[model samples]
Target: MAFLRPLGDTGLTISALGLGTVKIGRDQGVKYPDAFTIPDDQAVRELLALARELDINLIDTAPAYGRSEERLGQLLTGRQDWVIVSKVGEEFENGKSRFDFTPEHTIASVERSLRRLNTDYLDCVLIHSDGNDLEVLRQGTLEALAELKRKGLIRAIGVSTKTVEGGLETLRRADVAMVTYNLAHDQERPVIDYAAEHGKGILIKKAFASGHLQAGHADPVQASLDRILGTAGVGAVIAGTVNPKHLRENVEKARRAVGDL
Candidate 1:
């Protein structure tokens, strides 16, 4: 499979590197070290095209990512060619964020995501936890997602958790877990270890520490990804970059890091 890795037992394979679309949709409340303007539709179209050319198939978006879902729905083509992953529970509007984990909202959120993404189904839908990962899990979001999977709305369900306990619990009940992991943050390494042991999918978020770790290094991107991809259970690192050069650099570095090129 080269750089492609299995996404747990969900029967999906993702690349070692994946494109994050937040820069294409929202920039107001982001934490990137450098500020950026939201790319136009044409820019996003080209980005998606380049991603496909690089053999990157995973796309991560979320409701809290402002207009990301709507933009992807309008711009992304050949739906079957991508393994789309989106999130529910957090909503961003007018530069503010809100959370609702009720089962009713979960159902409505997935339905809304389907409409916004212009797809009948999503490969995975994660609970966009509000830092209270364990509490949010108990509020029926997982059960709701399970039902959605049964109904063919989402193939897999998981949580973008902020804590190790939540990560472990998510793997026990779901197919994937998105966690924060980077050179500066090894506190979550235990979560990745658990996923590795249990054959569960683990997607790495903040792989570059939200642009914090890239400064003051000769090649911090390579350094960060080498450490991340070298780990046993990581399925993919979702990095956001609207610049073509940066995107290509990330993919190339990630490919080299995987050592199967």
Candidate 2:
């Protein structure tokens, strides 16, 4: 089994490495108009099974990544031990996407997410704050999250913020906060420091910088990972992997990164 890291002061423990499902559903290649396609269901199932076998218990997905939640629902039906963290804020219509954070939309999104994820409740519900402003973060959506928590729809609340400042604002209220801190985006250090100072549970995203850091060179990726592990209060590093071997390799790398700390 891989090492289980604590989620800040929260008692929940998760694998240091998580499985992200964007590539599984979206286009796989470098081009935009003709992105890569998802593999067959059997292939996806094999990858998911391999993840479980390797003890990766946190599976992070978003409805924004075309049909990923549905696929994950189908794949994770029997296994209830894993932590399923899904995001809300994007609405898909006629194959197009729109962003909405109104309270009504948020409630509806959670309902749809529950249905698509095939679960009674989510382990974590992040207010997918992409381009969402401070007032939205402070007023209506925050109330919605508290309501959802009150209603038992999610065990914990989180926000996936791109900027460290945005994450820090959310961190002031959320039980968990997911931030994009990797070699390519090392500017998030101050936010990481703030979260550490407050003892907020932190989940580091983009640790591999969307495959750039993993291109066989230690250059920036390894250094950034080392820095994050050395940081005061980072909880777990969430780097998605479809390949089982790569998943194991990531866990080993994380262990090494945290070893000297």
Candidate 3:
């Protein structure tokens, strides 16, 4: 089985590998290595079922990921059994991306996410950093998220940081941190270490470098999981694959990675 780990002191446990929902919603303006057709509704339902059968409990989504949140709300059967992680600060509209981190936007975004996701509250909410991490943290965004948590609208709060300083600040101020750490780019390992030492949750993004490393390697998926999950602070790695076979493969790799640890 895929290992389940605690999301710091947030009182939530997440699978070591999460199913990312970006491809299920949006296919425009994406940086994927290759273009692919989006799957239909039945296909998505099967994928979610497969994820549950494989012991995957975390589903990563955001308002920026087109219609992902709504789709999850419609397709997911056992809402109480899974941990849903969404983001604020970024919104996708008409094939374009925009960011807002003000307190007003932060609170309003969480409320909208609740409505779209068909949930009373969110398991985790992150600041979708627009490469200005420090400024966002200082602009009462995290404070607003904290307020939501106080109101029982969110369980944990954090930022998807882009820089080392931002990751450090996230650790200082938030309950978790989403960072990019993989073989090609490991500049955020220090942030992982800090999270480990401090008992803060760490979620990995771009673990396979947006699928650019899929080709030209003997077993890139396993290699990537071994490296990232073997790290101390990582609570989960968000891997978005609509293919059921690939999803199982990733979960198998995650099991192996944790077993090796």
Candidate 4:
């Protein structure tokens, strides 16, 4: 495997293929809610160890992902070389989820994330967007992130946007941006191109489009990823998998893409 890829000119670099721990300890079949089963903690730990052995450094998780952060923390104890990235927004309640990004809630979420991840500082913290416009992008939240960065609580900050326009707008202002792209929902080319051109790291989510590609629909996956990587600003792609074999398959795909590059 390769070492790591720089997210931007800001000296931040991570593995090209990150492990999304949402399904590691939390409920499975989350993408298809009717069928859900959480994995054993020990299995999740072994998975983390395996990823590290493979030299995969970045582990992406979210507070809403039940015990994912905690599981990763347990698995990654004493491993400081790994880059842990997490997001804040969306809370779980009554077997449902709610979104909240007020300044106070964001800070609280970070605190909880720190405790859960058992980490002193997060490598990156992305603002979880609810598909909202910039009007809801809080100045206080940005200020809080700036404060965290200043205090060394977070190494960098970013936003999770669902549209190319929003991603571009975030790239224009934020240090990094996570956008949805893949064979299933490839709609952020312009923003990704701009990010690549301007030295912004573009993290891709939903590469498989919630199991659609895994169901023998590989063309869209290949074509979409090819198109995104061909664009300017893409930094790394985060594709989640609960199955180890499938995870390795995703890693192979990433390696092939990078090799072609």
Candidate 5:
């Protein structure tokens, strides 16, 4: 079985690998290495079913990921069994991106996410930083999320930080932190170490370097998985794949990476 670990003190146990739902919704203005067709509803449902069969409980989505929340609300049936991780501070429209971190927008965003996700509360909500992670935190975004947590609208709150300083600040104040870590780039490693020492949840993005590994190098997937999952304090690595075979291979790699631990 794949390893399951606690997401900090959020009382949520997540599998070593989480499913990212970006390809399910938005295909425009994406950073993925290749262009691909967005899966239809039936195809997405099948992929999600495969994820559950692999014991992946954490699903990472965002309002900026076009149509993802609404599609999930439509396709996802059993809500309580999965840990839905959504985001604030970013929205996509007309093939462009916009950001908002005001307290009102933050609260309203969470409410809108709840409705779009067809759930009363979100398990985790992270600040989708527009590369200004510290400013977002200083401008009352984290406060609004904390208020929501107090009101039972969200269970855990954190930030998807871009800079090391911002990531450390988030760990000082939040329950979890999402940072980009992979074989090619590892500048945010200090954040991971801080989370490990402080008992904060750490979610890795771009675990496969946005498909950059597929081109060069041998066994890049296994190498990436081993590096990230072998590190302490890592909760889950969010890998976005619409391909069932790819997803299965990732889960198997994760299982091998976190063997017996």
Candidate 6:
């Protein structure tokens, strides 16, 4: 089982590795190395059950991730045991993507997510950036989420940022920041550094470079997990995999990585 850790000052204890649910919902607009059929209901159920058996408590999903939130709504059991992290802003429809960062959209998005996820409150919500991280912050996305947090619709607020500048600002405005960090890309290291010093949460996306780093190498998974979980500020690493074998491998590698520290 994966161990637990605090997500900065948010007062939420999350598992060291989070399950990303993109594969359970949408498959059209993703950048994964191999094409996949969306997992059936029974498959999703077994995979989620395996995740819990492996001691993963954090589940990362988004409205942009096809029907991920909706399926999780229908499938997940014992919501109180999971730290659900979802996103607002970007929406996927008709194989196209659109972005909205206004306070009105942010507020409405959270409400919609609550309904689709079948949860009265989400553990954390992030602003999904369309590569315009600074502009989204200027648009008061965090302020709107803060309002929801105050109203008890969500427990923690943050942004899945694309820029170091945006990440720094997000740490100032919110409780957590989800940034891309992997062996192949460390440009966002500063954001993790800042979060480390400031007591803010840092969640890593693409910890295996969306599985790109898993091939043509010896022990790529362990190498990347070592650098990521070994870092001080990293609260969790979110890796989405529907394959039970790969999920088990990820959990084991993550355990060794954190255990080494």
Q: Model 2: per-residue lDDT, tens digit, 33-134?
A: 333457778878888777777677888888777778888778774557788888888655565667788888888888888998889988787877765546
Per-prediction TM-score to the true structure, in the order listed: 0.97, 0.86, 0.97, 0.89, 0.97, 0.97
Residues 212-236, model 1: lDDT tens digits: 8946668888899989999998999
Indicate the TM-score of model 5: 0.97
Q: Which stretches of candidate 5 lie over 4 Å from their true place?
A: 214-217
lDDT of 4 at 13: 76
Q: Which residue pairs come into collision in candidate 6? A: none
- Per-candidate RMSD, Å: 1.2, 3.2, 1.6, 2.6, 1.5, 1.6
**Against the unseen true structure, what C-alpha lDDT does each candidate score?**
0.92, 0.73, 0.92, 0.74, 0.92, 0.92
Ten contiguous residues minimizing lDDT sum, candidate 2: 27-36
Tell how far residue 165 is off in model 4, in angstroms.
3.2
lDDT of each residue in 5-48, candidate 3, tens digit only: 89887899999999999999999999897887788999999999
Candidate 4: segments with Cα more than 4 A from true spot: 1-3, 32-36, 214-224
Candidate 3 Cα errors over 4 Å, as ranges: 214-217
lDDT tens per residue, model 5, 91-199? 9999999999999999999999999999999999999999988888889999999999999999999999999999999999999999999988899999999998998
Model 5: worst 10 consecutive residues (lDDT sum): 209-218
- How far residue 189's Cα lies from its native spot in candidate 4, in Å, is 1.2
Q: After superposition, which runs of candidate 6 have C-alpha atoms over 4 Å from their true positions?
A: 214-217
- Model 1 lDDT, residue 131, Cα: 92
